[model samples]
Target: MAPEARIKILLKNGATALCAGLVALSSFSLGAEAARRHYRGHHHHIPQVPAAPPRALPYPQLPLPFEISGAQYLPLAWTDVKGWSDDNHLAAYKTFRASCKSINGQTGASEPKALGGSLSEPCRVAKTLELSDDAKAKTFFEDNFAPLRISRLGEPDGFVTGYYEPVLEGSRTQTDVFNVPVYRRPSNLFVRGYKQDSVSLPNKGPVYRKIGRRKLVPYYDRGEIEDGKIAGRGLEIAWLKDPTDLLFAQIQGSARIKFDDGGVVRLNYDAYNGYPYTAVGRVLIERGIVPKEEMSMQRIREWMAQNPDGAKELRRQNRSYIFFREVNLSDKDEAVGAQGIPLTAGRSIAVDKALHVYGTPFFIEGELPIDSERSKTPFHRLMIAQDTGSAIIGPARADLYFGAGQEAGRVSGRLRHPMHFVMLVPKGLDPSVRAAKLPVPDPRPSEKIAKLFPQTDPAKAGTPAAAAAPGKNETVATAGPVPLPVPRPAIEPAREPRRPVKNRSHRQQ
Candidate 1:
């Protein structure tokens, strides 16, 4: 009787406890739902779902200024090049032959690695061959080499501008009419190449010029020079009537100065203060001083004349400054380029020397200004790279020489258009083939990732994560990397030893 009663009592107590627990759990669930609904009603802006973490992207590759300047070459057939046959190759040959002298003179390990030894044989052939006409000269080039289109990485077309030797009327001494003074290179200025953390200025690479030896400081800018910073140092080369003419002469880097008498003096670029060149035309456009469509040298000059008050300040906005040395005005002297060779009027071109060889030939086909107003003129000529300029930065970029004098200045100023440039590479030296020989950087981003985060264990980092499947061989073309064109030193013509000038202000006309 006692066993049956105890079992029944235990079953009843367990049922009651289970029902109470279930009721408590239901009440808690209901309260939580009500609280969540109340919070949502009160806070209307907050999102209900939590945001996911952002995925990490691969670290980008950043190259130094030098690494990017590598010349990227793409090969093309001779027939593929436009207007190849019709060009006056005799003119190009004459210029090329002149360049050969410079090429032949360079010996030992100092030769340009880009051209290798290919230029030697072609240069020998150029010296002896006297082509009677353009037809024979064209045949010589066709037999010697193939054409390869050159460009910087990621960019397609190269820009070609025009530069000319400007002629100006001036006097040897400062008078009321001729007061502006041109300075010579300062003796104290020193250039320091690339530094990891620049000692003097921000991001100061290899091209920064400093002042003084005891206490090195940044060199004087254009404004300082105009303000008479180096005025008393006996640096005056010549004095001109118009300060604008002086500025233009500085920009051009060379000028023929006609004295009041029959005599003339040729001034060539010597050195520069380290500040980078900022285009004055760009400043005018930005300040709304002149409309972009009407922006030309003549137009800019007119605007400056009209705005007399702001002219000096406008010119000062460009920080770059150029110094000059006296060059002989002989028939053979002509206007020499940066390569120290006599520049042929129509045949010589100034290219990015950092990315190209001195004697390299490029066939440029673009519309130029042949007429007075400079509307449009067909230009398809083979240009020899005999010169270089600071602004000429890219692989395909070039500055075409348009001879000397005022008319040449007018035509040259009008040429600021894009052109198709094809480089005449020596025969058998294909750029693609040459590029294949060079080393390629690791393409796998993960390999770089390990390098970026060296603290992580190699075992934990896993095998080099690739962009493709495992064991797949991927090849990257190292022909040329994209380069940021850092400006070079001022273009200075090699001149004869400096001689004492006869100081005569009263002897002039």
Candidate 2:
């Protein structure tokens, strides 16, 4: 054959082989792409890759006048919630449902204390269920809500105090025996801007009284009120025997008045004098009179009895004063709290209404130093935010209600333990809405993101790009950069174990 013809035939065969290989490679790529799309569309039956443990995120701190300062939180998984499975959620469910009437009915401007519009769906879901057993209630709560562990600044624990409804011996009219006067909301007392003030604390709104023609001034303190300031106003509700009992009763916010004739009446918190609350127990601790670990209301009362001469001055140390309104206790044995609902014995808790809404569920774990055998025992349960107090200041702080009478008082007065708090917000409502209220800067910015998207302005690099990274947990917002979702780890397929071959040649060998 000719040399030119042979070279042309070799070139033609090589070209054909190259074209066949390219067609096969393109077909294989297309097949792989189709399989991936199919897998994404139908993934329900397939087992999901186990999620990595949730990383702690920086929660925003309150910045407004109404917000509790320095209070923050972090998102935690259900497994992170201690004693979650052990709690009797049915008891909590009962307490929560009691506040639903008030919560669901609530309208107008959203108040800080009660469940407003956000709780409507959860409340409705609760109303439909029978919730007869503990298991069902537990499941309901777990399915409906996610837990957020609350902290102050960065610390996970805070002080847990206790308060209770007191039962006092009193008379409607002032007598020789019953001389101490329990005053009503004075007629002369006025609030700033409004003709009458309805808010219970100074922080909620400014409280004032009309002194001159049009001038408004802060209402009188405990000292002035005890003197002659509210003297001839005909505002006295009832008179009690002991002055110390009246003082403690004011701090507790409610009292059941028992008469010699065996009849009883209730007095609930109506108004305050706008003065900041000073805990006398705290006063004793600061003065070095009583050690903080040993200080309790029972001990304070005993100290006051021992030194009657200085009792008057010590009682006056707390400038905050409480006024009461006569409430009928015919319907229920327990006193109605600030939420206008009957407070449960161990289930109710008093928090700063300015910080938390009423009917909100809080899971607390702490040890209470009550007088009974159960004192200094671990208490892990779900409690409802039923009331508010002057001294309940922070987001982590709470005053647990120990029911009524002397036993309740004994338990309540002695409790001064550190507690862990986990707030349960309603499901479906974006918790980021609350977090967005006060945008917190990321404490530890992403070093990887910062280096990748290096900022021209050195100052802005940590503040912007590093914060916007997904796993780094930046504050959620509409305007800021949307974080790219973290890619999940690829899962390998399962393989069958190989069976070893049997050795049958030993006898023949």
Alpha-carbon lDDT, every model: 0.75, 0.79
lDDT string, candidate 1, 334-370, tens digits: 8977777788988999876666778888999867666
TM-score of predicted model 2? 0.70
* Regions of candidate 2 where Cα sits further than 4 Å from its true position: 1-69, 112-116, 197-206, 371-375, 432-509
Segments in model 1 whose C-alpha atoms lie over 4 Å from true places: 1-71, 111-113, 116-118, 193-214, 372-374, 433-509
For candidate 2, lDDT tens digit of each residue in 192-273?
A: 6555646453434546788777887888998888886887679888889988999999989899898888988898888788
Candidate 2's displacement at residue 38, Å, is: 66
Best by TM-score: 2
Candidate 2 clashes between residue pairs 3 or more apart in a chain or in different chains: 113-357, 113-358, 114-358, 190-208
- Alpha-carbon shift of residue 275 in model 1 (angstroms): 1.7
